[model samples]
Target: MHNRLHLTYANQSDQEYLSIYGKAKITENRQKVDDLWSSFLKVWFSGKDDPNLALLCVTIEDAYYWDQKNNKAVTIFKMAKAAITGEKSDTSDKGTLNI
Candidate 1:
Protein backbone atom coordinates (compact mmCIF):
# COMPACT_ATOMS: atom_id res chain seq x y z
CA MET A 1 0.00 0.00 0.00
CA HIS A 2 1.20 3.49 -0.76
CA ASN A 3 1.82 5.76 2.17
CA ARG A 4 -0.04 9.01 2.64
CA LEU A 5 1.31 12.10 4.37
CA HIS A 6 -0.11 15.42 5.54
CA LEU A 7 2.21 18.43 5.76
CA THR A 8 1.31 21.77 7.24
CA TYR A 9 2.88 25.11 6.44
CA ALA A 10 3.91 27.20 9.42
CA ASN A 11 2.89 30.80 10.12
CA GLN A 12 -0.68 30.12 9.12
CA SER A 13 -3.11 32.61 10.55
CA ASP A 14 -6.12 31.43 12.55
CA GLN A 15 -8.30 31.88 9.49
CA GLU A 16 -6.20 29.52 7.37
CA TYR A 17 -7.03 26.53 9.58
CA LEU A 18 -10.57 25.84 8.42
CA SER A 19 -9.69 25.28 4.80
CA ILE A 20 -6.61 23.28 5.57
CA TYR A 21 -8.45 21.16 8.07
CA GLY A 22 -12.18 21.97 7.82
CA LYS A 23 -14.83 24.59 8.46
CA ALA A 24 -15.30 23.54 12.10
CA LYS A 25 -11.53 23.59 12.49
CA ILE A 26 -10.71 27.10 11.19
CA THR A 27 -10.54 29.40 8.15
CA GLU A 28 -8.13 31.57 6.21
CA ASN A 29 -7.95 34.05 3.35
CA ARG A 30 -9.74 32.54 0.37
CA GLN A 31 -7.00 33.27 -2.15
CA LYS A 32 -4.25 31.88 0.06
CA VAL A 33 -6.15 28.67 0.67
CA ASP A 34 -6.86 28.25 -3.01
CA ASP A 35 -3.22 28.76 -3.89
CA LEU A 36 -2.19 26.16 -1.33
CA TRP A 37 -4.69 23.66 -2.67
CA SER A 38 -3.50 24.33 -6.21
CA SER A 39 0.10 23.62 -5.31
CA PHE A 40 -0.83 20.32 -3.66
CA LEU A 41 -2.90 19.27 -6.66
CA LYS A 42 -0.13 20.23 -9.06
CA VAL A 43 2.11 17.69 -7.41
CA TRP A 44 -0.29 14.98 -6.22
CA PHE A 45 -2.11 14.60 -9.54
CA SER A 46 0.69 15.35 -12.01
CA GLY A 47 2.91 12.59 -10.72
CA LYS A 48 2.80 9.27 -12.49
CA ASP A 49 2.07 6.03 -10.61
CA ASP A 50 -0.13 8.45 -8.75
CA PRO A 51 0.71 6.82 -5.46
CA ASN A 52 -1.64 7.16 -2.56
CA LEU A 53 -0.37 10.29 -0.83
CA ALA A 54 -1.53 13.44 0.85
CA LEU A 55 0.42 16.75 1.21
CA LEU A 56 -1.13 19.27 3.56
CA CYS A 57 0.68 22.55 3.01
CA VAL A 58 0.24 25.28 5.59
CA THR A 59 1.88 28.18 3.72
CA ILE A 60 1.99 26.65 0.20
CA GLU A 61 4.38 29.43 -0.80
CA ASP A 62 7.33 27.26 0.23
CA ALA A 63 6.64 24.87 -2.64
CA TYR A 64 9.53 24.72 -5.07
CA TYR A 65 9.08 25.24 -8.78
CA TRP A 66 11.03 23.73 -11.61
CA ASP A 67 10.80 24.41 -15.34
CA GLN A 68 7.36 23.87 -16.71
CA LYS A 69 7.62 20.43 -18.16
CA ASN A 70 4.72 18.72 -19.92
CA ASN A 71 4.52 16.29 -16.98
CA LYS A 72 6.70 16.23 -13.89
CA ALA A 73 5.66 13.04 -12.09
CA VAL A 74 9.26 12.07 -11.47
CA THR A 75 10.15 15.43 -10.08
CA ILE A 76 7.11 15.52 -7.86
CA PHE A 77 7.89 12.09 -6.46
CA LYS A 78 11.39 13.14 -5.58
CA MET A 79 10.16 16.19 -3.74
CA ALA A 80 7.63 14.14 -1.80
CA LYS A 81 10.23 11.59 -0.84
CA ALA A 82 12.60 14.29 0.25
CA ALA A 83 9.92 15.82 2.39
CA ILE A 84 9.23 12.54 4.08
CA THR A 85 12.83 11.46 4.52
CA GLY A 86 14.21 14.86 5.53
CA GLU A 87 17.12 14.52 3.10
CA LYS A 88 17.66 15.26 -0.54
CA SER A 89 17.31 12.32 -2.87
CA ASP A 90 19.90 11.39 -5.45
CA THR A 91 19.37 14.22 -7.86
CA SER A 92 21.38 16.26 -10.31
CA ASP A 93 22.02 19.95 -9.76
CA LYS A 94 18.63 20.68 -11.28
CA GLY A 95 16.90 18.49 -8.63
CA THR A 96 15.83 15.76 -11.05
CA LEU A 97 16.07 12.67 -8.86
CA ASN A 98 16.05 9.52 -10.95
CA ILE A 99 13.89 7.01 -9.15
Candidate 2:
Protein backbone atom coordinates (compact mmCIF):
# COMPACT_ATOMS: atom_id res chain seq x y z
CA MET A 1 0.00 0.00 0.00
CA HIS A 2 1.13 3.54 -0.68
CA ASN A 3 2.04 5.54 2.38
CA ARG A 4 0.71 8.77 0.99
CA LEU A 5 -1.61 9.35 -1.94
CA HIS A 6 -2.94 12.66 -3.20
CA LEU A 7 -6.11 13.11 -5.25
CA THR A 8 -7.28 16.28 -6.97
CA TYR A 9 -9.73 16.88 -9.77
CA ALA A 10 -8.20 17.94 -13.03
CA ASN A 11 -10.40 20.63 -14.52
CA GLN A 12 -11.57 20.54 -18.10
CA SER A 13 -12.68 23.43 -20.32
CA ASP A 14 -16.17 22.00 -20.66
CA GLN A 15 -16.62 22.20 -16.90
CA GLU A 16 -16.86 25.97 -17.32
CA TYR A 17 -20.51 25.38 -18.04
CA LEU A 18 -20.79 24.53 -14.37
CA SER A 19 -20.40 28.19 -13.53
CA ILE A 20 -23.32 29.08 -15.80
CA TYR A 21 -25.35 26.27 -14.24
CA GLY A 22 -24.27 27.22 -10.69
CA LYS A 23 -22.74 23.74 -10.35
CA ALA A 24 -19.04 24.42 -10.52
CA LYS A 25 -18.43 22.62 -7.26
CA ILE A 26 -20.46 19.65 -8.37
CA THR A 27 -18.45 19.34 -11.53
CA GLU A 28 -15.23 19.65 -9.59
CA ASN A 29 -16.39 16.88 -7.28
CA ARG A 30 -16.89 14.54 -10.25
CA GLN A 31 -13.37 15.26 -11.38
CA LYS A 32 -12.16 14.27 -7.96
CA VAL A 33 -13.97 10.95 -8.38
CA ASP A 34 -12.14 10.35 -11.63
CA ASP A 35 -8.86 11.35 -10.03
CA LEU A 36 -9.36 8.99 -7.13
CA TRP A 37 -9.88 6.05 -9.49
CA SER A 38 -6.87 7.04 -11.53
CA SER A 39 -4.70 7.24 -8.45
CA PHE A 40 -5.87 3.86 -7.24
CA LEU A 41 -5.00 2.27 -10.56
CA LYS A 42 -1.54 3.75 -10.39
CA VAL A 43 -0.86 2.22 -7.01
CA TRP A 44 -2.75 -1.03 -7.46
CA PHE A 45 -0.77 -2.00 -10.54
CA SER A 46 2.55 -0.53 -9.58
CA GLY A 47 5.63 -2.80 -9.90
CA LYS A 48 3.58 -5.74 -11.12
CA ASP A 49 4.01 -4.93 -14.80
CA ASP A 50 2.08 -8.07 -15.62
CA PRO A 51 -0.29 -8.20 -18.56
CA ASN A 52 -2.43 -10.79 -16.77
CA LEU A 53 -3.18 -8.36 -13.96
CA ALA A 54 -4.17 -5.40 -16.04
CA LEU A 55 -6.83 -3.12 -14.69
CA LEU A 56 -10.21 -2.90 -16.37
CA CYS A 57 -12.36 0.15 -16.78
CA VAL A 58 -15.97 0.08 -15.75
CA THR A 59 -18.54 2.68 -16.68
CA ILE A 60 -21.41 3.73 -14.46
CA GLU A 61 -24.50 5.30 -15.93
CA ASP A 62 -26.97 7.78 -14.50
CA ALA A 63 -29.57 5.02 -14.42
CA TYR A 64 -27.80 3.59 -11.36
CA TYR A 65 -26.10 6.69 -10.07
CA TRP A 66 -26.32 7.33 -6.35
CA ASP A 67 -25.16 10.16 -4.12
CA GLN A 68 -22.78 7.74 -2.42
CA LYS A 69 -19.54 6.70 -4.10
CA ASN A 70 -20.28 3.05 -3.44
CA ASN A 71 -20.70 2.33 -7.12
CA LYS A 72 -17.00 2.63 -7.84
CA ALA A 73 -16.04 0.83 -4.69
CA VAL A 74 -18.32 -2.07 -5.46
CA THR A 75 -17.06 -2.38 -8.99
CA ILE A 76 -13.47 -2.36 -7.84
CA PHE A 77 -14.11 -4.98 -5.20
CA LYS A 78 -15.97 -7.27 -7.55
CA MET A 79 -13.30 -7.04 -10.19
CA ALA A 80 -10.64 -7.83 -7.65
CA LYS A 81 -12.63 -10.80 -6.46
CA ALA A 82 -13.17 -12.12 -9.96
CA ALA A 83 -9.49 -11.84 -10.75
CA ILE A 84 -8.43 -13.59 -7.60
CA THR A 85 -11.09 -16.29 -7.61
CA GLY A 86 -11.23 -16.83 -11.35
CA GLU A 87 -14.99 -16.45 -11.29
CA LYS A 88 -17.22 -13.87 -12.92
CA SER A 89 -18.05 -10.81 -10.85
CA ASP A 90 -21.38 -11.12 -9.15
CA THR A 91 -22.16 -7.41 -9.19
CA SER A 92 -21.88 -6.98 -12.93
CA ASP A 93 -24.61 -8.18 -15.24
CA LYS A 94 -22.48 -7.99 -18.37
CA GLY A 95 -19.14 -9.73 -18.67
CA THR A 96 -17.35 -6.64 -17.33
CA LEU A 97 -20.04 -5.59 -14.90
CA ASN A 98 -21.15 -2.23 -16.27
CA ILE A 99 -20.95 -0.44 -12.97
Candidate 3:
Protein backbone atom coordinates (compact mmCIF):
# COMPACT_ATOMS: atom_id res chain seq x y z
CA MET A 1 0.00 0.00 0.00
CA HIS A 2 1.24 3.50 -0.77
CA ASN A 3 0.13 7.01 -0.09
CA ARG A 4 1.00 10.28 -1.78
CA LEU A 5 2.62 8.49 -4.68
CA HIS A 6 4.83 11.10 -6.26
CA LEU A 7 6.02 8.72 -8.96
CA THR A 8 6.17 5.15 -10.22
CA TYR A 9 8.95 3.21 -11.96
CA ALA A 10 7.62 0.69 -14.40
CA ASN A 11 7.93 0.27 -18.15
CA GLN A 12 5.28 -1.23 -20.43
CA SER A 13 2.55 -1.89 -17.90
CA ASP A 14 -1.01 -0.86 -17.13
CA GLN A 15 -1.85 1.32 -14.17
CA GLU A 16 -4.60 0.89 -11.61
CA TYR A 17 -5.59 2.29 -8.27
CA LEU A 18 -7.11 0.32 -5.34
CA SER A 19 -8.66 2.52 -2.74
CA ILE A 20 -8.26 0.77 0.59
CA TYR A 21 -11.25 2.13 2.40
CA GLY A 22 -14.56 3.15 0.92
CA LYS A 23 -14.93 6.35 -1.02
CA ALA A 24 -16.05 8.24 2.04
CA LYS A 25 -13.56 6.71 4.48
CA ILE A 26 -10.57 8.17 2.61
CA THR A 27 -8.04 5.96 4.45
CA GLU A 28 -8.57 2.27 5.04
CA ASN A 29 -5.22 1.39 6.53
CA ARG A 30 -4.63 3.32 9.71
CA GLN A 31 -1.20 1.72 10.17
CA LYS A 32 -0.05 2.98 6.81
CA VAL A 33 -1.26 6.44 7.65
CA ASP A 34 0.62 6.28 10.93
CA ASP A 35 3.69 4.85 9.27
CA LEU A 36 3.84 7.54 6.62
CA TRP A 37 2.36 10.22 8.82
CA SER A 38 4.40 13.36 9.22
CA SER A 39 4.07 16.72 10.94
CA PHE A 40 4.11 18.38 7.54
CA LEU A 41 0.97 16.41 6.66
CA LYS A 42 -1.00 18.38 9.19
CA VAL A 43 -1.05 21.18 6.70
CA TRP A 44 -2.98 18.97 4.25
CA PHE A 45 -4.97 16.83 6.69
CA SER A 46 -6.61 17.75 9.91
CA GLY A 47 -4.86 14.81 11.57
CA LYS A 48 -4.42 11.05 11.11
CA ASP A 49 -8.14 10.76 10.99
CA ASP A 50 -8.45 13.41 8.33
CA PRO A 51 -11.10 12.44 5.73
CA ASN A 52 -8.79 13.25 2.86
CA LEU A 53 -6.19 10.66 3.81
CA ALA A 54 -6.07 7.62 1.57
CA LEU A 55 -3.87 4.71 0.40
CA LEU A 56 -3.17 3.39 -3.08
CA CYS A 57 -1.85 0.01 -4.21
CA VAL A 58 0.52 -0.20 -7.15
CA THR A 59 1.15 -3.25 -9.31
CA ILE A 60 4.02 -3.78 -11.71
CA GLU A 61 4.63 -6.52 -14.26
CA ASP A 62 6.84 -7.28 -17.27
CA ALA A 63 9.63 -5.06 -16.04
CA TYR A 64 13.02 -5.23 -17.70
CA TYR A 65 16.51 -4.02 -16.82
CA TRP A 66 19.16 -2.48 -19.03
CA ASP A 67 21.81 -4.87 -20.35
CA GLN A 68 24.57 -2.44 -19.45
CA LYS A 69 24.50 0.89 -17.71
CA ASN A 70 26.56 3.79 -16.43
CA ASN A 71 25.81 5.78 -13.36
CA LYS A 72 23.31 8.42 -14.46
CA ALA A 73 25.19 11.24 -12.76
CA VAL A 74 28.53 9.91 -13.93
CA THR A 75 27.21 9.42 -17.42
CA ILE A 76 26.05 13.03 -17.57
CA PHE A 77 29.34 14.21 -16.12
CA LYS A 78 31.25 12.14 -18.64
CA MET A 79 29.23 13.62 -21.45
CA ALA A 80 29.99 17.13 -20.19
CA LYS A 81 33.63 16.31 -19.66
CA ALA A 82 33.85 14.86 -23.17
CA ALA A 83 32.64 18.16 -24.54
CA ILE A 84 35.49 20.03 -22.81
CA THR A 85 38.15 17.33 -23.21
CA GLY A 86 37.22 16.51 -26.81
CA GLU A 87 37.41 12.84 -25.85
CA LYS A 88 34.74 10.22 -26.44
CA SER A 89 32.53 9.38 -23.50
CA ASP A 90 32.10 5.82 -22.31
CA THR A 91 28.49 5.64 -23.40
CA SER A 92 27.98 2.05 -24.50
CA ASP A 93 26.34 -1.23 -23.56
CA LYS A 94 22.78 0.03 -23.12
CA GLY A 95 19.65 -1.88 -24.11
CA THR A 96 16.66 -3.68 -22.70
CA LEU A 97 17.54 -6.98 -21.06
CA ASN A 98 16.21 -10.34 -22.29
CA ILE A 99 15.75 -11.72 -18.80
Maximum-lDDT candidate? 3
Q: State residue 97's C-alpha deviation in candidate 1, in Å.
A: 22
Tell me each candidate's RMSD, in Å, in order: 17.0, 19.1, 10.5
lDDT of 3 at 28: 82
lDDT of 3 by residue, 37-96 (tens): 899988888998877777765432223333224555666888899999999976544333
Write the residue-wise lDDT of candidate 2 on 1-99 in tens digits: 322222223223222111111111112244444444544566555533424343323222312211222365676887798999999865533122132
Angstrom error of the Cα, residue 26, model 1: value is 54
TM-scores for the candidates: 0.21, 0.23, 0.39
The TM-score between candidate 2 and the true structure equals 0.23
**Candidate order (lDDT):** 3, 1, 2
- Deviation in Å, model 2, residue 20 alpha carbon: 29
Model 2 collision count:
1
Point out where model 2 deviates above 4 Å. Answer: 1-70, 93-99
Global lDDT of each candidate: 0.41, 0.38, 0.54
Q: What range of 10 consecutive residues in model 3 has the weakest lDDT sum?
A: 16-25
What residue pairs clash in candidate 1, if any at all? 7-56, 9-58, 15-27, 15-28, 16-27, 16-28, 18-26, 18-27
What lDDT score goes with residue 28 in model 1? 40
